[model samples]
Target: MTTERAYRYRFYPTPEQATLLARTFGCVRFVWNAVLRYRTDAFYQRQEKIGYHDASAFLTQLKKQSDTAFLTEVSSVPLQQCLRHQQTAFKHFFAKRARYPHFKSKKHRQSATFASSAFSYRNGQITLAKCREPLNIRWSRDLPSAPSTVTVSKDRAGRYFISCLCKVDTEALPITPKMVGIDLGLKDLFVTSEGQRVNNPRHTARYARKLARAQRQLSRKQKGSNNRAKARLKVAKCHAKIADTRRDHLHQLTRQIVNDNQVIAAESLQVKHLVKNRHLSKAISDVGWGELVRQLEYKAAWAGRQFIQIDRWYPSSKRCHGCGFVQEALPLDVRVWDCPSCGTQGIDRDLNAARNILHAGTALLAGAESCSKYRGALGN
Candidate 1:
């Protein structure tokens, strides 16, 4: 299948390139905030909905004015792209898929997207609009094809990255009869139906002390001072480290799972609601359940494997995989429980959940009759 894929790499910008990119980022942010404010006021005050074309026209008019002429100095593609992005955000909001769009902040990570016309690519070199020299990109891997679009971004830690979107062909993996079910938890990252347990690294907890010390040093420094800025960068670096490590680990783990199994089943967890518990919220977030599921989904699709998510309301943990007997209550603290009806003792809670999930998912895939029977037996 031909799919659009993005490859991101860290890049070191020249002094002149950095200055131009900084200006471009600021311009994009300013345009987004201004257009968002305009649309918001128009909606509440006059019951008007500002579309992308109208916003684009507004941008053109603003450029003609003396006060905002600097917008024309940088690449115009990214500015227009931001307005389109805002339009998409508003669309998603009205469709109830996302919350209302908000104004961009200068202190946060900044990015600018450039369309094909705004940049030139040749011999593994990329040159943005209005620049004489090509970007000094550290090519980690060769692109399958030239990119159709490019995005440049800078994080709070002052690291620059460029992402190239290119079209590539992906072939499906060979057919496998192996299937597995996974149970996610705080103690172990995941438990498989086959009784394999993957340990949760707890990346955030590993760096908690260093992050707290950096934050403390930042709080002591005067706001707007150079020392404060340095301290803030330190804190950002710690966070970046945690995020990078977690992402890398998830990618590796998901790839292995997808390669090994033809059918993968897991419970559908509402991470937002799950994080409401103050006691377990930090641990839940540290485990990156959402990220794990997301990676599994896309990678499974790319590999042409079946991925199933059991219903959240399904009694996976409480239901006995041996006899289909459903327990009334199974507390989180009780990791080992016996099925009273069947007298099956020492059932590992997570492992039982994984087996039940596998049974439910396979029954679901079999037919509606089987699913109905399974649900009836489980009282779900």
Candidate 2:
């Protein structure tokens, strides 16, 4: 099978290259902010929406201006890519897929994209545009194919990475007969239809005290001082570490689940609405239901496995898998319950939910002619 994947690697830049890259990042940020301001103003004043072409056409004039002449120091490719990104952001906003484009901040993550024309790879080294020396990259793995584009980014922790996007050939996994359903929760990341439970890593909670201490240290330092900067970096590193741990665990879990099951079913959770409960919000976010479902979805597609999401309002937890009897009031505190109709004793709520989900998903798949219809049904 053919696939498009991004390979990311850490790279160390020489002082000169670092300066140039920093300049490029600044220029990209500047262009994005400038165009956003322009677009916002035009939309409000003239009821006109600006687009990529208009932005690109105006870039030359922008660089020629006295105040913004510093933009000339960086390669024009990153500036153009910045405009393209802003344009894409606006498109997503209009489509209601994302929020409106906002001004880029220097304090946060900064990135610049390089198109095929902007970089060249030779003799196991890659040279970026306007740089004399190739970046010293720590290649963790070999690329399947030559990358068409690369994105360079610097995180708040002062770590630099380059992500290369390329098309690659993939060998499809062998089809399996087994199927399973998953119920996500705070206590356990998920409980499978096979009575298997993957405990939630609780990455944020694991390091919460350390993060709190680091944040406290950051707050104690006076703003604009070197100590404050160091403290901020510490906080960033802590956050990065937590995020990395969470992501690594999720990837491993998802990979194993997808590989084992030919058909994977899960609840279509309304996480945004669920997280409104302030008491449970932290725990809910820490579990990352959305991230898990997302991984299962894309990985399932890649593996040619069926991924079904039962409707959120399907009453999976309340319904007894044995007798298909629905309880009128099943409270969250009721972890174990006996089904009145089926006389099923001591059934775990999460396990029952998983089984019910699998039953519903299989039934829907057998009855429905189109998967798109089921997807639309869940969306509603």
Candidate 3:
């Protein structure tokens, strides 16, 4: 089996290289926004009258009208990759995954990138095609053999990264017979059917106060002053550090889960909806529920294990895991209860919920047609 992953590296750019990098990033942004506009026009025009062709042709036309000439200088890989971003947006629209294609704005985030294999990376230095200076490399991982492309760009906080796209041989993991169901909650990050409850790290909230103070300091600084700029960098660095710590914790947790379980079952959490509800918003966001689901998904696939996502509204919390008995109402405050039907004492709410999730997933694995209506109270 073959798999693809970007091995990112940090590059140290000199003043001249930094300027050129900024220019390249700007050019990329311009192309992306232009393609978005073209796609939008094509969409509307097609609705009025069919005047559309393939996306590649539209991208080709944009290249002809390039402003920086830097756009033309970067290998077609970055250009094509840049265009692909817009195309992906268009695809999402067509597939009803998103409402409409949104315009790209340079002011929103990180500036530019050159994503092509044409950039030379040798002895900790990378040479871009149009630029005279070479970037000092901070290689994080091995480069793919015979890569189709590589991208060099800076992120929001002035950190440089390189993304290489290449094919690599990846053997499929052997499918295991074991299966486990996972229930996610604000109280605990994850609870397994086997009575394992992973504590909600709450890493984001732990550092939120400090982050808020940093932001306040940043806001007080004069916008154009060097002190203000340095202050901003300090804030950015702190935020990055927090993010890295959380990611590290998550990686260790997810890997442990994946390594232990075979057939992994989990509730399809309505994270976006849950976040909007003001009462538990902070707690909800703190746990990174959405990110957890994503990690479990890709890792399960990578491990060649059965990863079944039960319905979002599956009544895992309310239902009795022992007898599959449904309950009327189990409020968020209620942590445990005795099942009327089965007379089984529920020790912990999250564990019971996880058990229910596992049971429902098992029913699904057994080819059940219907799924539970809610992961919480059935009626709610």
Judging by TM-score against the true structure, name the best candidate.
Answer: 1
Candidate 1, residues 1-380, lDDT tens digits: the string is: 99999999999999999999999999999999988988999999999999999999989988999999999999999999999899999999999999999888988999999999999999889999988899888999999999999999999989999999999899999999999999999889999999999999999989999999999999999999999999999999999999999999999999999999999999999999989999999999989999999999999998999998988888899988998888899998999999888899999999999999899888887763544577785564
Give a tens-digit lDDT track for model 3, residues 254-326: 8878877787888887787888989888788777878888888888787777778888776778777666677
lDDT of model 1, residue 311: 84
Question: How much is the lDDT of residue 112 in candidate 3?
Answer: 43
Model 1 global lDDT (CA atoms, 0 to 1): 0.93
Model 3: ten consecutive residues of lowest lDDT: 371-380
| Backbone clash total, candidate 2 | 0
- Model 3 / residue 137 / CA error / Å: 2.9
- Number of clashes recorded per candidate: 0, 0, 6
Better of 1 and 3 by TM-score: 1
Q: Cα RMSD for candidate 2?
A: 2.9
Per-candidate TM-score against the hidden true structure = 0.97, 0.95, 0.85
